[model samples]
Target: MMMKKKSKLFVNCEEAVKICDKSQYNEAGLWDKIRLKLHLILCGGCKKYSSSNSKLTSLCSKAKLNALTHQQKEAMKKVIESESAK
Candidate 1:
């Protein structure tokens, strides 16, 4: 129907954002990417948001960040607990 076709081509800002994130992770479907690109063309705010998201993703990959190890995390937790107990 008309509604279904409209929904397929257009997306709100929130849905656009979700699709943008999924696209970044290579998880978005082709239809979703098409919808997101259409929405971004029509919505400046979403376009800006998608651009920023891409930049952040690129920066994070370049940074090559790492999370604390289990031992490090346990040590930090114990320190926090001990401090709180004092």
Candidate 2:
């Protein structure tokens, strides 16, 4: 029982990153989040990765990214008008 407890308590940097990503998606279990939190306290690389991931997530979330080109939009509009006229 003691060894089991010890073995499950800490995760390595790799596990922490995977867990952190899973956590961002709400896919990680409670125990996984706890273990990830513990690992982040000790592992600087994982912590940095987690922070960067969070920033990327939030930036993507709030960013109004417009990918359509003006030419594409005009072409699409012309297609729609032609279709509607028929």
Candidate 3:
């Protein structure tokens, strides 16, 4: 019996997802991008996920969303604590 070695370009779904996320953030290296693209070619689910991720990122960027400041979070927490105590 002969064992075949795994190709360096082969990536499982999990790793593909991680790579997809990194690619979205422009954090994936060239090899990782190539692996992700190859995996996406064969994986319908991951392809859909990548599409949705891209759409979501685009929507978030266009939405101009803002986060609460630390003071606002502390105020909200105090309010919640007081309400809980009531």
Name the candidate that leads on TM-score: 3
| Tens digit per residue, CA lDDT, model 2, 1-86 | 36545468888787788899999888999999999989988888888999999998899889966789999999999999999999
Per-residue lDDT tens digits for candidate 1, residues 1-86, read 36544565778899999999999999999999999999998999999999999999999999999999999999999999999999
Instruction: Compute the lDDT of residue 84 as modeled in candidate 2.
Output: 100
Estimate TM-scores for all models.
Answer: 0.82, 0.66, 0.83
- Count of backbone clashes, every candidate in sequence: 0, 0, 0
For residue 25, give model 3's deviation from the true position in Å: 1.1
Off by over 4 Å in 2: 1-6, 64-86
Write down the TM-score for model 3.
0.83
Residue 28 local lDDT, model 1: 100
Clashing pairs in 1: none
Better of 2 and 3 by TM-score: 3
lDDT of 3 by residue, 1-86 (tens): 99988779799999999999998899999999999999999999999999999999999999999999999999999999999999
Model 3: ten consecutive residues of lowest lDDT = 4-13
User: How much RMSD separates candidate 2 from the native structure?
Assistant: 7.7
lDDT of each: 0.94, 0.89, 0.95
